[model samples]
Target chain A: MHEFAIARSLVDAAIDVARNAGVSRITRIRCRIGDLQQVDGDLLGDAFSAVCDGTVCEAADLCIERTHMAFDCERCGTTFLVGEWDWSCPGCGESGSHARGGDELELIGIDGELNDGNQSAPKCV
Target chain B: MMEIKVLRNVFEKNDRAAEQNRELFDRRHITCINLLGGAGSGKTAMLESIVPILSQSLRVGVLEGDLATTRDAERIAALNVPVVQLLTNGGCHLNATLVQHGLEALMQHELDLVIIENVGNPICPANFDLGEHLRMSVLSVTEGDDKPQKYPLLFKAVQAVLITKCDLLPFVDFDIERAKADIRRLNPTAAILRTSSQRGIGIEDVADWLRQIVNERQSLVAAP
Candidate 1:
């Protein structure tokens, strides 16, 4: 559903960056998605394939890195990885810890070849 | 090989649109509330009940989001207020871009409060922001009490939870206490209110709360 929209953005961003870097073809795209986004990796990959058709990123590969959710204990100032929705602080046994990460959906980097009016080696820009 | 680090959020466009919408609302001194709920969570019914009361003292406008119908807009237009229906075609959720367009149509009139009734789906709509001052989700007793746990993102993102269809609470097996407790656990700061638009219960309180928000914004706008 909305994965189509997300994939469209991802492809567009990759193309924009590749063109800005004077690269003709995007080899791969590295993305970091947090757990809180709740995006289905398989669905996003399918969507990317569908959206990449007829675009510069048609042959590009999408690499996704899932970030785990973590929480910061408000009472004890201890940060811990959330285990199965457990909000209790292991240090103080107190509930209601503030969420501290795992909601990111960012494009980390891109790997492509530079087309500087001549043949050149593949570059990760 | 060159490795260029972009470090850009995929939702950057949507987030930027939402920020622009917030700026527009602030500049106009308008309080916008994004009303979210399931298909039959009494979102339209609650609006039908509260709009009249809210229109009594404050200028009100509504942006109705539906997959493919103007029926909700027709209903709100009957109230004689500025109402715009946004057809998302088959989109599951309304994004900030759609809301930006809706606001352009709604702002033609001098409105103090604008309510954007998002397309009925708890999961997808929870991920998108429509640039509203407040986000309120409606849950009917018929939807069951476990919804808060099942749709944690929707429950956790809202500033208020409206338990609609309270008149049917006695007949249904929905555990109000458990639902409230779950909502509290997920969002301790969210205001939970029980409302029955059919029975005219808690309508005044909801209207009063909206009025207070509008008044507060107006004062801020009027201040130095």
Candidate 2:
């Protein structure tokens, strides 16, 4: 349900970048998602296809890169990775209030081709 | 064949809208809170109990989000305060854009505190920020104590957790201490309060907490 809204945003972002780069076709759109998002990639992919219809990103591939949750203990200063909902620091047994990473939900980049140029080099926009 | 690095957040649009909402709230000197919970978690009941107490000192407003019904708004309206019903149709969550519209409608009244009753799913609503000063979630005894572990995202995102329907705790197998421990594991700073709307327990405490927040905001606005 809400994935449709997120997918629409992703498509809109891709189209915005493509139009700015003067690209006619988009090959792929890559996203980095964190564990906190709890999004279903399959559902998001389906939603992306549905929302991208007739748009510049209609044929684009949605590549989702999932990032795991990481935490830094404030008590012992031990940085540790959370396997699944485990927030306690294994070193000092203190529950950390500080999070180090893994809450990312960003559009990393896009792969596309220019309309006027035959140069196939990847444009890092 | 070329890959360009965009490096933009997927929630950038929503986050930008939320910032705009925050600016509006700050400019108006209003303290907004997003109330999140499951469908039958007694969120409306808790509001029903607290709004009266809150309205005695502070001007309060409510924006009710539901899939299709205006029933929650009706409940809040019975308290004789400013209330708006937002129908999401079938959307699982309420986004910042919707909250901006809700604020626009609610801003007509001079409210000190505005509580947005988000759509009743624990998962999807946790992912979106509605530009609230405080985020609180209601969990009922019958919903089971393990819910905090199952829905860690929601528990982790909230600033407070209201354990509602405590009157039924005698019959239910809800382990309050265990639930509190689990919630603390996820969010060390979240305030956990036990409340029973039917018995009028802990309603004043919630109201007093909100009042403190409103007074703080008022002082900040009054300051240079």
Candidate 3:
């Protein structure tokens, strides 16, 4: 499902940071999704856990935050949240639609543990 | 444990690939379209009817995406136009990486217009960006007008919606007005065209809509 792909992206991003920073284990990942995107938090959590298994992100806790998308009405100059698939402006009845893009689906950050001296000693050579 | 602040879009990787694809298409003066719809929505049928019409004035090509079959590609190939089949191999949708490879194969033709017929699904395909100038969705009358509300994301993302199988309207309980209203609520600017590939109804209008975009690109390329 769509949630699985998003979960994969989140895990990959966390892993990328871990590798680049020489972190041995990732503990948590935080993401923010837009209201317009139809992502179910429960499904996303399940997918994240599924994809993180056996990876550096294994057992990592995933935190999700939802954000609202504001629609700018060109007619009445009113910026508002579109309700129930109705893009029409409440003030002027002017329909406002914004192109969907990566404005949503954000990965805020990650928490990880640095490698121990013994584990990182091999890289010193 | 160390806290790191890395604010990034989850779709950044795919969006970058799509931007690259768009750049490539722009350089080549190709008007690429991402065609999406549910299974049996008459996407291929629309292409089968309109390809010939569009080909008369511009060089046309197709990149067909499906779960595990070359059937749609085969159908497009039969039209004697350049076509490529992108097999997702059980994947629900086609991503930008797959489309980049498909575009490489299709690049040799020097096409003016390329239509990527996305895998037959309304929901999954709506999430992906395959480096297209326009995103069009096909919905047949048999699926009912209420479908737009059920799958609002797809309706919201598409620039145009083709209500196909209009010939069957007399036999079905599909309310065309309700369908248009639902679509307009989500997308006020999407051109909702009624089409029946079987009867050749509204085929010219669909072709003309595409033709205008392609010709605009052509005119821009010709400028300077």
Alpha carbon lDDT of residue B41, candidate 2?
94
lDDT of 1 by residue, A36-60 (tens): 6778999999999999999877878
Put down candidate 2 lDDT per residue, A3-92, tens digits, no spaces: 888898888888888898888888788899887777888899899999888987777778888897666777888888765555578889
What TM value does chain B of candidate 3 have?
Answer: 0.96
lDDT of 1 by residue, B1-224 (tens): 65678888787788889999999989888899999999989999999999999999999999999999899999899999999999999999999999899888889999899999999997778778788989999999999998876676777777889999999988999999878866775677888989999999998888887888789889988999
lDDT string, candidate 3, B3-78, tens digits: 7778887877888899999999999999999999999999999999999999999899999999987989999999
Residue-level lDDT of model 3, residues A6-115, one tens digit each, is 89988887788778888888878888887556788899989988999999889578878777656666667776764765556777876543433323778988777788
DockQ of candidate 2 against the true complex:
0.52
Q: Which segments of candidate 1 are over 4 A away from where they belong?
A: A71-100, A117-125
* Order of the predicted models by TM-score, top scorer first: 2, 1, 3
Residue B78 lDDT in model 1? 91
Write model 2 residue lDDT over B99-200, tens digit each, in one string. Answer: 888877899999889999999998889878889999999999999988876777888877889999999998999999878877876787888999999998
Error of 2 at B116 (Å): 0.5
Worst 10 residues of 2 chain B by lDDT: B148-157
